[model samples]
Target: MTTTAPTATAHRSGRRFETARQVADAVLFEGYVLYPYRASAAKNRMRWQFGVLVPPAWAPAQGEHSLQRTEVLMEPRGAATLSLELRFLHAQRRTVQEAHADGTFTDTPALHLPDRVLVPWDEGTEERVELRVAVPELTEKEIVLPFNRPAREDTEPVLDDHGRTVGRLVRRTEEAEGVVRLHAEELEGPYRVLKLTAVVENTSPWTPDGPGTAREEALPRSLVAAHLLLGLTPGSFLSMTDPPEWARSAVAGCANLHTWPVLAGEDGRADVVLSSPIILEDHPAIAPESAGAMYDATEIDEILALRTAALTDEEKREARGTDPRAAAVVDLAETLPPEVLERLHGAVRSLRAGTGAAAAPQEPAPEALFTPDTPWWDPAGSAPAQPTPDRVLVDGTPVGPGSRVTLRPGLRRTDAQDLFLQGRTARVEEVLHDVDGGVHLAVTVEGDPGADIRREQGRFLYFQPDEVTATEEP
Candidate 1:
């Protein structure tokens, strides 16, 4: 949906919105290029890995999707207004052309020049659409807003020191179209809760050439890294990942397809929500120590910087010519100071007593955990240097090695596989403690065929004390 102007509420929220934008920017370009940022790199060949909204005509054939739907709960104090900002990337083709002697330009995959090398690659251009609507209006009927971008082409002539036109760079963009549909429904709960549903669909009319059309061929007409930022005034949004006790039933009824919504912006502020294709917890923020975008979000900045710095001169030149952003990454790594590199090595966000551990008399500063004599990597260097205990207390019972317990993986910290282990009986193999003084019980499934083999190999599933209940031996 497109709004010609920003509403007053949007103006007031500019500061808070900037915080969300920083994180959204990271998601937008994630995997745009990988380490060793060269166009010829194998990993770089396959692009647009996240939140790709392809044209409807090609989605079914390609086994991809063309739409994202998000349902979130919001509590409005009075007449609440909602503002949405949809952001995505439009893939643009950049072709390197060499100027012929006879006043003609021919396309070439790579054009070599004395100063720098030019290579053909696909680049992304940012697209944003904003919409504002009153809560009452959405309850009446669904609102559909259509947006379109027309095809575009641009060329820049490459020059020589003698002021002669040597070659040219041509950039072309395909047309794209989409629609945003929004509506709201009131819940039956005692609180004034409204379930907001938003849908983003790719309405581009482009069709595939044939059944064999590859993903790269269809990406030109697709929306790359599409996501939404929702803002509410005089209202607050409930967390879908962790809802309040009263709204648990209503939250369970909400259906979110291909998109996960979580609280955004500053911590403890529920006025904004970020709907993303990648699953994330509430109030996600970009690491402060990061120098710039490396396009590989899962990789650490220190490792990427060191690897980028180790690239050969010729490789660096090619990477710089691949794309403008890639060039910035090369420059950042080459010029990064030692102190900044050290900062990227690590940062502790929080420290608390582990489950079933005694409360400390006083919380220790983060710096206190490190010392000149003992390195941070050494497990025994930190406070509570004793080895792991042979047993741990579960419901006031000393469940030591060989104790039997029923797994009850908590929803907050367990994965899908852990859910399947719920209520299964297991034998405690050992008790371990982490640097933070948290307790973990290693156990092997009772009936698994490989249980004996796993014990010999020292591999077992671990659970916190609170996630398991002691059971009497048969």
Candidate 2:
């Protein structure tokens, strides 16, 4: 099978592909670096904590894998075609070398200059391998595509104001080899359903220097943040998470190893699929309010920007010298205008009228409660409907404040603390409605010594209406 280098021109041809690309970029740098953005940060030392495909030779010892397999069901029209883009990062070791007067350079961890400082760090360079094949071809025989990127070294001379070379930065990249195997099997059913399987493996040859070899040593030869983006013409892929009733059994039979396949692009579009290392729902999207990539996928952009802006001068200087991306992050946080920063404070995607007992009562105007200078974030300005008198329907039972109930945490509990609260009896303190119109029950555990204190402090454990059953009063 023939593979081609990915080009922007080719990607721009398809509007659906472009949408998928945006989400893919976010996944590529999900954990490229962490907060503090300095090379010396302890958390930053252990980098590439995502879908890393290491060499087969060292994978067993490191307890990591060398391959990722994604399987999805697709319904293709006559002579449909599939395009695959495999994207990943290649680790590059950057060494700082100070120039000596004798026409030689000596390696240094850091080189301090008049205006700036340079530090040795590992950086990532993006790599993409693209291929296209016909659906009929995949069904006939499995296609194996092998790709190799040769190793190389590059140097950048750091010059002083006098045009003399003060120091130089040398970046060395190790060779990487990988293979992609694609095959399809037609499933038995009334409708023509095809199960497509794509496997990516790291075939780079590597040898450990010693038994004590570390993960960092193996990363250079590994495929960091490896993932696949699939686009189809005249075909739609099924959602594994919530497949149709008819295809549920078939979806469950497919094996996806170390990767999750989710529909990409528009909310209802199925022409594209993103097989990621991180679990996501169908039609995943990047929030529009996001400033840019912050490398920490689980963090709030506003909080990270605030923390980055709050770094001391010394810390910021160190972060700026770490990597070009880190320097950009520091500049973005510091130079962001107050108005733009305010936009990152909060965002509500959708709002609708509440339902059942969770319906909110109209409140008086803000002017009646607070002065014109009241801050937007002030509680009084956007106070929630009084929760004490509010009520929510639990299994058609009206549960309100002072109501007794038995706690039953949902199967998908967000907090681990809920495990201890399971099956416990509690008294409903309030019934609350969130910005999204979802109802929650704030309750205090029964017979707790600190229940009165918690009530005074307004601290209570919250549960969804479905997570509790109304009980008769004692």
Clashing pairs in 2: none
Alpha carbon lDDT at 242, candidate 2: 89
Q: Could you give the C-alpha RMSD of every candidate to the true structure, in order shown?
A: 8.9, 8.1
Off by over 4 Å in 2: 1-14, 352-474
Per-residue lDDT for 1-474 in model 2, tens only? 534233211342257578888888888999798888899999898889889999998988778999999999999998898888899999999999999999899999888766457899999999997778888888887888888888999999999889999899999999999999998999997789999999999998888887789988889899999999998888899988988899999999999999999998876679899999988878788877677778865578999999999999888888888888888888899888897788787654323222324335442221122223444344554657654449878889888999999999988897888888888899999888875778888999998999999999999988889899989887
Summing lDDT over every window of 10 consecutive residues in candidate 2, give the lowest-scoring window. 363-372
User: Could you tell me the lDDT of residue 271 within candidate 1?
Assistant: 92
* lDDT of each residue in 1-474, candidate 1, tens digit only: 333333312223466578888888988998888889999988899888999999999999778999999999998778888888889999999999999899999998788766457999999999987788888877877877778888999999988788899899999999999988888999897788999999999999988889988887778888999999999888899999899899999999999988889999976689999999888889898877788888875577999999999999889889988988999999999999998898888765434222222335344332233223444343554566456678889999899889999999997774788878989999999998886789999999999999999999999999999999999999
How many Å off is the CA of 324 in candidate 2?
1.0
lDDT (CA) for every model shown?
Answer: 0.86, 0.85
Please give each candidate's TM-score. 0.76, 0.77
